[model samples]
Target: MGHLFSKRKSRVTEHDKALLQLKTTRDKIHQYQKRSEATVEKDRQLAKKLIRDGKKERALLLLRKKKFIEEQLKKTDGTLDNIEKMIQDIEFSQIEMQVVDSLKIGNESLKQINAMLSIEDVEHILDETQEAVEKQREIDALLSGGLLTEEDETAAEEELDAIIADAIQKRLPEAPTDVENPEVVLPDVPETLPEAEKKAQKEKVAMAAS
Candidate 1:
């Protein structure tokens, strides 16, 4: 009975040692699970921070692009205004040039009209001078000829009166058709005495006396 009691006591001691080793292994596994869960939480926080930062950076870039576009639009508007002003200036210059050219043409036309009027007046004066010269020549020819009798003088005076009346009438009116187509009538010639007949009669009287 004493030997049996000692063997039983040794068996109980070996079972106690086995139970302690199992408890220690379970504690070590729990510690390892806790450490893994902590690492996972830390990684999730870092990913959230990265996502927020990326959104902020994109928003800032969009704002900068919008500002740049607005500045470019302002510059383009100013350039367009300047171009419009230049176009207006060019149009005004063209209008002014046209006006100047019109004035110059008008002045030249007026000068030409005045010159033509002066030429017409000069032609009229020359015609009057030629008529006066022809009248003086006719008067001198009549004074130098003594062949004009009183009847011829009277006839010439009547013809002169008619010519003066015609000239006076034509000075302010048109010339007559008969004056343009004048009849050129020739004058009658006188007969001449024969000198040979008188000479023959004288010779016959002398022969009878002999």
Candidate 2:
């Protein structure tokens, strides 16, 4: 009777152990599934961000290329005008020497104007390209969680406003009232550094001066 009781007890203990093992295995499988789902969601978000970034980059490149082509076309048109003028001058039989000289001066002036225009166009293109790059960086930082701060968002908004203001100023003439009351305000400059840093910087400056 005692043996029978011991055998029964051992059987129950074995069953409980099996049940616990099974539960642990099930729990592990569930945890694995949850982790996988989270990973997949993260990857999806990253992929979406990458697609957006790529589109922005492509758009900026296209804009820059278009602007460059337009500038080239303008320069080519100016060159064509000069060429036609030269051809006309060659065909003229009663062209006075003074008229020929004047045409030469006009051609020179046109060349200078074209050069200045080209420089201005190139500078404008550079500025726009830099702005596009900066915007992309900002977007990248935001998507990557690097700039997940209210201050960052506020700064981005200010920068965007400044960019819009600049564009508006370029496209429209300033009103007299606008000139009198500037919409943009300059940021305050720091007048002094931290005490320790200031002392260190002053020492460095003294050393450099010496």
Best by TM-score: 1
Please write out the lDDT profile of model 2 over residues 21-70, one tens digit for every residue: 55565555556556655655555565556567886665555555555555
Residue 53 C-alpha lDDT in model 1: 79
Model number with the top lDDT:
2
The segments of candidate 1 whose C-alpha lies over 4 angstroms from its true place after superposition are 1-54, 119-210
